[model samples]
Target: MDFDKIALEPIRLDEAFFHKLPKVDLHVHLDGSLRLETILDLAIKDKIPLGIETIDDLKAILKPGYRHKSLDDYLKGFDITLKVMQTDEALYRTAYELAQDAAMENIEYMEVRYSPILHTRKKLSLAAILESVLAGLRDANKDFGIESGVIVSGIRNISPAISMRLAELSVAFKNRGVVGFDLAGSEYNFPAKDHLKAFNLILSNNVNVTIHAGEAYGPESIHQALHYCGAHRVGHGTRLREDGDLLNYVNDHRIPLEICLSSNVQTGAVADLEEHPFRFYHDLGLRVTLNTDNRTITDTTMTREYLLAYENFDLLPLDILDLVMGGVKSAFIPYEFKRDSIRRTKDKVKKMLVEEAVKQGVTP
Candidate 1:
């Protein structure tokens, strides 16, 4: 399998073929990716009062793929998901189900992230909140052989004091199924620097940090995330193109940008799919990786995200390989483990390319 030769032609694959490729999702939000039926069931079990009688009715309201007026507007759907996710059973179920869903899509690994503070609404202790999700992920790994990790997140609109608490929880769960710490939520008025104290704790303790920036805000938010907060990766860096020097710095430093393409369109980060900076950033040699920010909210999967990149950017098999390698390299797994995963991913992708070439009657 000579991928160098395959790089010469762009491969148009079906969804079924894309499903057979190995994938990673580093930026998926657990609360926003719940299954619709599961949400209804949880609501009934918890007596959460969803106000919808059937799945069709609930589906009409969610309208997962519909375009929103703004990022804030797209976030209203969370209120409904959060309502039913307050109990331990709900957390475990959702976490387990998310892992199952990812596995079905051929995602070999994923980092599920959410704010523990939000799950504490039912007077659930922070440790309980974190543990329940971990337990589900652990069980899923045992059953499906899909490796996973949890990234405890701190919301931006929330106070720094609360972010600090979430950071401490992230530190406490360090190697116990929690891979990293993150700052998520509204990026407009609230800046990443405002959560400096939490980042400081996350840093001093030698934990991985990834922040949501440059989505609602601009390049400055990404700058603050990298410079002030020390993010190893920037989530939804839709606006990093606004600053040239910083863009080069990011490229020079090899910092991975978790690009969520469809989510950007639905959330109004980009006016349309064609306007996404993914092609530009990839052309400029930045380590850009595709992800499903909120699978249900954004109505996407790892396969779908890659397909969009393939069709929209006219990507070849080699380009897909670059994205795959970038994702494995940017994973927060320990050095030796990540190195191994990268190697395995390369082998799997190479084999898949060969299989596809045979099917297409294209000799490499």
Candidate 2:
């Protein structure tokens, strides 16, 4: 079992920075991040025999060793979560609670992804699943004031026809809440090029598209994601750092990489935090955004990710602030909205830093 915890030291910082900082999460999987207590409660209510008697048992199932050996192994965790998310009640609850968790973390905006097909086993139609997720988001919004949207994903290993249907569904619901279409799943055997028709359909319909690329494979996966699949953003594009040309191209285009540091480490996307390509990409001025791919599976949160990155990378407050701004800039929103949001966040972060520096009697 290669379940080594990534070594990390606590980052000593001012309290104000954590509280006042506004952030955005561009990539997160809804079902993959459920609270363990919620999962257990739901399992009991639904009479789903989870075999595990305690939270520790559940944690072991989600640990890296139990996680997929390849891209396939990583995605297998979603199956267990998705099984518990079949009913409209469960789906809505998970989506709403995910939003609540994001709000608690002070995430101002976030986009959640899931494969609608995976949640339809109980004869719940695709529209029904989507509607349930939207209902949860709306419910959470009324309570927490967090902005959220959905990105419907097509399982990459599935038939191309099914992929196209998913893309069409994403297009149909774009105005409703579906902000984009994504190709997710195993990356080695199932390349981005395998779903070109689906991505093309998405593009033709003017639906935003992103692809899970460069996580389990190499730079060619990223190339196909951008060039062949027409992906506007790359998910877990850790392998892009291996190629200087690809890195330059990504920076030149300002394409955002949705980085999941802990998830990457746990899933064997990289050897460890020190080996994480996020530092390389950030140093090269790539549009990089930090995220919790699956909070429970990775046993992490956005705040924890920031703290670890800060300590491991020796990142300054301004750099952390810049990363927040980077997430806003990379959001799959309309141009005007993205521009205005980034500008406002940048100004707010600057003011916050200045206030902190004043309190500490140091120039920041």
lDDT of each: 0.90, 0.82
lDDT: worst 10-residue window of model 2 = 1-10
Total clashing residue pairs per candidate? 0, 2
Query: What TM-score against the true fold does each predicted structure earn?
Result: 0.98, 0.92
**Weakest lDDT window of 10 consecutive positions for candidate 1:** 3-12
Clashing pairs in 1: none
User: What lDDT tens digits, residue by residue, belong to model 1 across residues 1-364?
Assistant: 5766777665667777778889999999999999999998988878888898788877777878779999999988898889999989999999999999999989999999999899888899999998999999999999898999999999999999999999988899998888899998888899989989999999999999999999989999999999999999999899999999999999999999999999999999999988999999999999999999999887888989988888789887778888988988999999989888888899889778867876798865
The CA-based lDDT of model 1 is what?
A: 0.90
Which regions of candidate 2 fall more than 4 Å away from where they truly are?
Answer: 1-16, 64-69
Candidate 2 C-alpha lDDT tens digits along 77-149: 7767877899999999999999999998789999999998888778999889999999999999999999988
TM-score winner among the candidates?
1
Kindly report the root-mean-square deviation of model 1 from the true structure over all alpha carbons: 1.0
lDDT of 1 at 327: 88
